[model samples]
Target: MIGPETPRRTVLRSALAATGTAALGVALAACGDKDSLSEQANSGSDKGYIAGDGVVTQLPPSKRGHPVEAGGKLLNGKHFDLADWRGNILVLNLWYAACPPCRKEAKDVEAAYRAYKDKGVRFLGVNVRDGAAAAKSYMRTFDITYPVMLDTAGRVVSALHGVLPPEATPSTLLLDPKGRIAGRVVGEVDKTTLKGMIGDLRT
Candidate 1:
């Protein structure tokens, strides 16, 4: 069970671990509130990038929003639509190449996908930044086998803006079989927590 906490130390660790030594020169920063992320991005603080506060929220069916309507060309140039995944549990991970937490959690997300792909679950990545070359490089580095959408135009982000905050890289969203938002983790994903969330949806 993944609970929520706002410990600055924990947040720092996750961010640094994801960034690796090569990116250490860049300052690590984050926003506890979704709106704060937008403000930070506009102000050019830390390049307007936002790391999550390690918060996890799961909504009951009644609390979920309407089915998400988003899709676009993938890194492989394939079209993807959220609506088409309605019958299976879906996971959407929003990330950019430079996000430390995204780097840290890539392996775990891929593991989860491999574990659940044949069990009526699907995972899609939404890359908010990076061109094909950079995005593909990141995917290769992380050994990510899931489909990742190139959301450079922010079309997918705009569609999911109701639940996903702008500039909140490394945010993970879970959708129930019906395509409505079911849960979210706003930072480096805890592997056990993610698997537990997926298990709960199965039941």
Candidate 2:
């Protein structure tokens, strides 16, 4: 027998559907129970968070956004302020431990950092989610020596609200020496491409 739909039932159904969808996306992205939250980010699902599509956008100096003002504590408990890195190009990467794409691109990121670190280019990581232990473990596993900001509360993400929200788990933002956003990569960054961008910024 068919019954008339009630408001309570309607709301419940909607809620369940949304929950299921989110769970499904996460599961697919995660691939396995052992996969960390960062690895799951590689699925590129559009449940709530933005999924990176490997798109690169470089803005001309005249059209670049204003300087970014954000700061947070690193995984090792050291405070990091973006302003301190001024006068040098900064590469900021948003990542998490469980993201597969993030893991895949870690080496490339480190290589690029090594290639440009002595040339006045700096690299910082923004761990979107995960505890310090997890983040530190991931870094150790990936051999990433760069300091990563622990953004457990999304403070850094919120600070970049309009200019660069870092909607994707593995997003990369390039800041010119003046601290203005110069380039952005929505997904895993390509090593050569990143090196090229940094080279151009130096000129």
Candidate 3:
């Protein structure tokens, strides 16, 4: 049976109720799932977003240094040595699974790793404030083919610069073959953008 038309307020209430139901569905699906949470964090109606240092036109600025001391291991049960990746251009990401933009870029990073892991290019993940389980799950979920380290203490967090405004989560810092700082990306980036920026290694 058809129901009679209701007042404008009643229609608005019904619309809101429907939206709430959809949101609940999304939450239920991602309950306790790290990758799912990451995907949800990055999902929005916005078709695209251009993130960069616009007006100021200035980035963190690259510095010269060797062998990331604050890096390696302090959180994970094991350790990682920056020296091992010497002689290779590498993409270094400092992120937390809980960070929205980090999740958004996780897949792109993995794809790049697979495409260049054999081309003398490397990808290293530095996880901060995230345990082994979450970090592992994130890697597996995204089919990541690279190695990651857990930096629970975030000791190297301060040393690894080159992030944009927010300068908080989803930060990407590049390291040259000699372990020196090379530009950075503060938010999610596409494969083409990454490829272009990585070209700096030649200089």
Provide C-alpha RMSD values for all models, in order: 10.2, 15.1, 17.0
lDDT pick, better of 2 and 3: 2
State which candidate, 1 or 2, has the greater TM-score: 1
Give the TM-score ranking, best first: 1, 2, 3
What TM-scores do the predictions have?
0.75, 0.72, 0.61
When summed lDDT is taken over every stretch of 10 residues in candidate 2, the lowest stretch is 10-19
Model 2, C-alpha of 84: deviation from truth (Å) = 1.7
User: Per model, how many backbone clashes are there?
Assistant: 1, 7, 0
Local distance difference test, each candidate: 0.67, 0.64, 0.50
lDDT of 2 at 192: 78
Residue lDDT tens for model 2, 77-187? 887777888999999998888876777778999999988899999999988888989998999998998888776776555444333333566778888998877776655
TM-score of candidate 3 relative to the true fold: 0.61
Q: Candidate 2: what lDDT?
A: 0.64
Ranking by lDDT: 1, 2, 3
Clashing pairs in 2: 36-98, 37-98, 38-98, 38-99, 39-98, 39-99, 39-100
How much is the lDDT of residue 27 in candidate 1?
A: 18
* Candidate 1 TM-score, true structure as reference: 0.75
Judged by whole-model lDDT over C-alpha atoms, candidate 1 comes out at: 0.67
